[model samples]
Target: MPKKFEEFKLNRQILNAVEEAGFTEATPIQEKAIGPVLSGQDLFGIAQTGTGKTAAYVLPMLMKLKYAQGENPRALILVPTRELALQIEEQVRLFSTYTDLRTVVIFGGIGPKTQKEQIAKGLDILVATPGRFLDLYLTGDINTRSLQFLVLDEADKMMDMGFIGSIHRILEVVPRKRQNLLFSATMSDLVHKIAGDFLKNPLTIEVAAQATPAQTVTQKMYAVPNFKTKINLLAHLLKDDEFKRLIIFCKTKTVADNINNFIARRFGEDAVRVIHANKGQNTRINSINSFKEGNVRILVATDVASRGIDVSEVSHVINFDVPIVTEDYVHRIGRTGRAFNEGIAITFYNEAERYYIDKIEKLIRQKIDEEEIPQSIFIEETPFDERQAIAREIDAQKRKENPDFKGAFHEKKKQYTSPTKKNNKKSYPSKNKKRR
Candidate 1:
């Protein structure tokens, strides 16, 4: 039987807020993690996305903080990206509705003047990206003397983004006696190294295996021949009403833009939006809001949005390009099958992407079911340039595996004609006649 929130003995005010939030029972991660958090122990958690991990730590921390009487923040949550910072802040606000717990979220891509002002006004919980947090801390706007709880959300992504130095710096500034919580979807070597340094005899929690996708998501893939054909397959899939709300993840900003244009042209302007690192902060926020409100049917984005988005009821997540970083495969598909909702994940891969597909399967410990392309959709022939590109990519992969391996694009040695009597005699006679 699942555990109920009431059994956790939370305060009446927080119970009321939980009831209003419509959360009756605790998720597995929440059930196991909340107790340790409330007991004030350093913890290291390994769970995939959409597992209610945020609330696992947030609720207990809120209960501990109680009435929120502090001039500076008592609890700090650090995330990798601006989107995730906003998402965590939203969660903190929702659960702390019945209390006076003030919250502020700070991130980069915008000026820090307003964020500093908010900090000056006093807050109980501070959610911020590492870079912006360091910036504010350096400016003397943030006080760490009163911090009691520290949480690192998506620690693996933070490591991937090369925020280790910033994290180390933040660790140096914060008080050493505080409780620490580190949550990550995958446990890489780097995460392990940080965990060794960050935690103090912490309790370890593993709700699921590392890099595993949620069971609620059905996985499927198609062997697409070329870029145009992949687009055609996408169009065919979208024609069905079942693909109600979907996110298409691309490998690069250029591909994301191309997909956005194609989808917009086919489904009209309001049906789609694209987001990437180059897009402005307001544009990214507004696009996410539009998608969440159902104003947009499709969102095209790169991996920057992979672990950041928290939308539930997403019908499908399409991988327009296979991620070279295998762990990201888990985060990309995790966007759907959220909140225990049944969802589907579809991937389109060309010949060169098979290498990444294999790595993903190994990481997830499951083989994605492959399906043939529908005959109704026209299969475009691979363009010469695209074919060469694929070949070059394959060669690079091979060279990465073996340094001495020569690529297929290398110059070919001239073939020496064997001494055939007829060919050799004819060559001599032709040479004599030419001389004459």
Candidate 2:
């Protein structure tokens, strides 16, 4: 049995807010992490998304910070993407409803004028992406001298986005006596390196194994032959009512757009929306809102939206493409099975994607249950170009495993080239040779 939130000895106001937010029992992460955070100790948390990790840190931080204070923020939370920053800010507001703690979130993709103005006003908590935070700090709009708490949410993602330099810069400017908190779903080498530099004798808490998917989420995989066949399978599956409020994750912007168009044509346009890096900030937010509000049944998106979305009761999460980043498979599936709700996670993999599937299984420490293609759906033949691409990818994977192992593609290339062809060609004089 899990512990209750009241056991944490939180203030009545915060308890009320937590109750209003529909949380009564503390999750494993919250139960373990809140105490250390309240004790003013550095913490390193290894937990997946939808594990109540946000509230785990936020609640304790709010309890410590109490009410709003000076003009400069006392607590700074850094995230990787704008979506995640906004999501964290929303969580802060939701948990701080009973208190007067002012919070603001800033990111790129728009003008910084509004963000600067918000910073000018008094705020207790500031959530921001690394780039925008650095931009504001460089312009002298941010004051880190008053910071009492610093959090690196989704530390792995930030490191993946190459924010280590900015993080170091921020560390240099901030007061050295503050508490540090780092949270990540998966602990990569980069995350480990950052932890060495960031935390000081921190308490490490792990609710689950690194990169492990929630047990509440039932996992399934389909051995798809080609993209078109995958589309057919998707169409067949979406016809069922059980796929309510699902996210279809693609590998690229082009695939996301294609899936969105196909779904729109099959279903109504209002039933689906798509988001990727190319989409504007407002557009992305609106699309995500529509999905969260149950107005959009399907959200076609790339990996950018994987760790950022925080919707509850999502019935399913479909991996339209196998994530090349194996750890991302955990994050993508994490969109569902939130708040202890039972959900389904389905993945589609082509011949080339099987390699990634193996890696994902190793990372998650379990094999995904494979399902056969439905008889109602037609499996299209692999196109010649696509077949060649898959072959090349397989060759690349082989070379990655064993550099000396050249596959059939290499042999085919060798077969096409003539050894005497080079001798038949006219040779040009070297630049160093003097011409007469």
Candidate 3:
């Protein structure tokens, strides 16, 4: 049975646009969210990315504003990153094509004056990153006092990026009486706090369990001995003709660059590309575009690509490094297996990485099917070694992140434990400098 937009009470114009855009079926998230949103109810929607979330919010917002249009806007959507904000703006324009609505997007990395001018011209829907939105709001250029709808898209990523402070500030400026919709692939404590604060008797529309991996994706693991063998394994997999449009995820910017260099050194410079936190916005966008156009066969990226990457035809996802969080694994694998396409996700594992595997299983709620090691691939190489050196390097990286941390003693590393100091009488002699 073909599902029509009218069945969900979507108006004629939106139904026409959906058909024109070639969307014949409502995705699970949309099917659940659109009805509640159209009736002017607060919603907390949880669904994996590329499942038509942008349209889910945009369609309802557009319908609500169809009978009414005004400058200075009644709706506001906040996203965590500039890429997501712009993507939302693009979708808004597409979905609101038949209407005379004015949707403006504000984000960093560009001059604020232009954004101010666009907002000054009047906006019916404003999609913005939290920082820039606060910037213009503080400047008295943005008037969100009349805002009627607030959508916090990708609430998990927003909290991860430290936007809670800005989100709070923006909420303070906007009218208290409004509809708040929160959408994310995973539900976290941070998300719960926001829901507690912003939503009033909200409808919870969770398409699946939190941190759940998409059913269209099949995940596998390879217990590579160490980093070098991991590289060789990546190379070998890349050389296979079936590995098309691959996104190799690395743990850090340096690792992403290193893996990109390794792939480029053997294969050509154009064969693989890397994007990470240090990349400029233009470079990141260009790399994403080139990869989308098939100019770059492989894209090695950090967590930046874990969200906001909407490409649909990825054939394989290789985790060059295991994800630090299990929720990230779901987002990483979700980059592929989209739009009903079957895709494969492969991860390199070592002894140290085994701890994350169970967490990943528990999050996805399924045991990952293991494949027998292809001995021919390992036969030519020296025997594999567990990643003790890699562990040391990761430990050093952790120390760099938290220098003041005095690590807890582990049974295996007890030999390396430092001796504790005994309290000395001389050290606290009359402990009062003021007495002097």
Candidate 4:
């Protein structure tokens, strides 16, 4: 195994940048993946977040591109989210600082004229989301004939977001002979199918067991009764000084907004910021940057921001609600315990969410330690409507587990309505009977 990054045969400029970045040794993924990528082979890598997978590809890509002399981008990177595109572009810039390589990032939510202007200036590396990339390509602004490398970062995420059609269209446009690299945290069937279409007998690299959480993060769970109790538990947890910098992950924009308001009210406005799809692009970017810079103590976000946003030294990751997407649990907690740092992940699940929690545990291949709810925290009774909703969900889950089993709601409807209808028919007065 290589002791340091220099052993990977990277160019002097990349070496200098890596040293400056303080990466003393190659991470497991980086150590294993850099060689094949540098050898100009198609690669399929399975690794979790914070495994230094970005550098594994970025360094080699930079070395291959060497100096910038192209009228268009020689390499194209497709990410699932705009934040990921921006983050990858930042990484490309960081690694290519000492070199002459130029990088540009294009995504949705901003006017294309600016992106077109940047592309017209010429670049070696172009990082983009599928929608924006295809739009610029179809508009005759981007020239893909010169593309030599194609990378699909977070391939599973792209598939989850229904980008397969865009990916197919992109494949039609880009040169067929270019190298391909795919990186995903989980190797789902969809990912494999896309890989078969994209890669040419690729080298498969699995750094760890698929869908497993990072070992550096300590995982625990709290069984709150309802939304209000969840808030109470969260407030109690935030009181601990250990939770210096934290992220609260919610399932929806509405939940994220509510959590943001609650936290801000309790902890003050200066300490909290919220990011979700509903927020304006600039606002989302600013909130994320603020959290990354430690200007804010807490960030409330939905799953849309879960996969690619990298913040350093995050002390804790709190799941404000159980993610319905089982795989998301891994990515959500991955916000903490980055770069081999010790961090904690606390999840709050009510009775309805336990089904999702079970799926998450099965995906991660481990049970989360259950933490007792403190007596000091207020446990609110589940609201009537919320209780009904929870019961319906539970019944649905039970039916899913056993197809022969009827749901509680179904049984109740059948029992009460059917018997009442039978009784009414049996008791109906006939014309033959005399009036009472």
Candidate 5:
């Protein structure tokens, strides 16, 4: 029998909030994680994404943190993306609705003035991205000396986002004796290295097999030759009314923006939304809020939008481009098929992407069914020449309208590398010079 939330010896106010929020049984992660966390021990939890890990950390943190003071946050959660930060904050809010556990979500991409004001007012729990948190700390806007719990949520994703330095910065300030929790969907050597660095004889819990797809999701793959053909297949899938709600993942923000523009022009603007790291915080929040409430049917986004998306009823997840990393494939499809709900995932692969298919399959330990294209696509589809012409025209228009759009993390990294005194290009440190 699974442990139930009501069985825990928690404050009446928190129990009331949990009951009001419609939670009864604890998830597998929560069942295992909550006990150790509540015992005031460090933890290293390695479960795949979409496994209710947020609740695992929050519930116990809330229970043990009932001594919750008014202003400075007692617990701190560091995540990689703004979306994940917001999602975690929202989960904490849901369970602590009736309690006095004040929570705040913090990230970059917006002015810190508002966030500084919120932090000054006091928070019991602070969810933040490392970059923004470091910035705020450096500016003396927030203090971490009172923090009792520190959580590094999605630590692998944070490393992938090049935040190891920021993590080090935060580690310097947080109390070393505090309860530490490190959570990651995949347990590779790199993740394990960080976990070992932070945890001391901590309890480790894993709910699902690492890198495996959720049991409720059915995955399919389509092999195509070129980008143009992939675009045609995407258009065909989008037109199908069977897909009530869909999320299309692109490898690059440019692709997401282009796809969003195309969908917006073909369908109603209200029917499609696009988000990425470059988008303002309000735009990202609004896009997700609209998509959650059924106001928008399709959202084109990059991996930045993939984390901490909590919509339970998303009908379909389409990978417009295959994720190069095996771990990302797990996180990408995790956007759907949550909480025992069934979902469909479709991916487009080409010869260059065949390597990715092998990696993803090996990680998930399952063979993805090869999907047969709809006959209607062949029947009504225009000639290849005409389609290519139209596609090129659309591509040209997008280029003209949105010139110099950033592609992916790597692309943006290259574009923004500081110029050297010798050349107007990224500078590299001399090996002779000391790094420290």
Candidate 6:
């Protein structure tokens, strides 16, 4: 039997908000993480996305904070991406609604003046991306001396995004004696290293092995022949009303934009939206808000932009491209089957992507079921240019694994041809004989 939220002995303000938010029972991660957090212990949590990890940290932090106090923030939550920072800030607001705790979210891609003004007005909790947080701290807009609680959410993603230096800088600025909490979906080596720097004898919690997908999500894959076939299959899938709310994850911004344009043309402009690093902050926010609010039926995005944006009851997650980073496969599919809701994750891959699929399966410790594409959906033949591109990519990956292995594109060096014997003798023998 699972424990109820009441067992955690949360304060009335937090309890009311939890109830108002319609969460009666604690998730596995939440149940396990809350107690340690409330006890003011340094904690390192290993839990996947959609495991209620946000509330696991947020609820207890709220309980610890109780009510807002001074001008400087007491609790600081550092996230890897702007999307995550905004999402955490939203969670802070939702949970802290019944209390007087004021929260602000700060990230880049926008003017700092507004954020500085918000900081000036005083906040109890600050959720920020590393660069923006450090910027404010360096400019004296944020004071870290009074910080009591330091949380690094999505620590693995932070490391993947190359925020280690910024994280180190932050660790230096914050009070050395403060409580630390580090949460990540996967406990990679770098995550462990950073955790060593942040946490002090932390209670380690692992709800599940890292990189495992939620059981509620049915995973399957289509062996697509080319990009056009992926688009065709995507169109086929979206025709079903069961996939009313969907997110298509692409590997790069260029791919994301192309997919978004294709989807927009097929479905009306209002029916589809896209988000990536190149998008304006407001545009990204509005796109996410629209998708969350169900005003947009589909959102095409890159992996980085999709981090920390949560929408409950997402019908499906479609991987338009195989993620080179194997761990990201788990995060991408995690967008669906959230909160124990049944959902589906469909992946489209060509032959070249098989290597990544194998890596993903190995990391997750499970095989993704293969699905045969229906004959009605035309499979585009691999064009010569595209074929060569894929061959080169595969060859490159092979070379990384085995430097001595020559690839499909590798051609034997042309045999050096010596001049004909008679011609060489005629040209060189007279001078050589004279010298000899």
Residue 326's lDDT in candidate 2: 86
RMSD of each: 8.0, 8.5, 9.9, 7.6, 11.5, 9.7
* Tens-digit per-residue lDDT, 151-208, candidate 2: 9999988888889999999899999999999999999999999999999999999999
- Provide the TM-score for each candidate, comma-separated: 0.93, 0.94, 0.85, 0.93, 0.85, 0.93
lDDT of 3 at 163: 86
For each of the candidates, give the backbone clash count: 0, 0, 0, 0, 1, 0
lDDT of 6 by residue, 1-436 (tens): 7889988869888888989998998899999999988888999999989999999999998988888798999999999888988888888899998999999999998999999999999999999999999888889999987799999998988999899999999888888888899999887899989998888999999998877988899999998877877888898888888988999999999999999999888888989999998999899999999999999999999997656679988899999999988888889999998998988999998878998999999999999999988867876665555655676789888998999998655665222123355643442232111111
Q: Estimate the overall C-alpha local distance difference test score of candidate 4.
A: 0.88
Provide the global lDDT of candidate 2 against the true structure: 0.91
lDDT of each: 0.91, 0.91, 0.79, 0.88, 0.82, 0.87
Model 1, 77-176: lDDT tens digits are: 9999999999999888999999999999999999988998899999999999999999999989999999999999999999999999999999999999
What tens digits encode model 3's per-residue C-alpha lDDT throughout 1-436? Answer: 5355768776788778777877888788888888889888999888877677888888988888884456687889999877677668877887777778888898888788888898888879999889998888889888876788999998988888888888888878889889889998887888889878888999998887877778889899887655666776777788899998989999899989999888899999989888888898889888888998899999999987777677789999999888977778888898899888889999987655766787788878888877654644542232212223444545655565688644432356564343333222222122212211
Q: Higher lDDT: candidate 1 or 6?
A: 1
RMSD of 1: 8.0
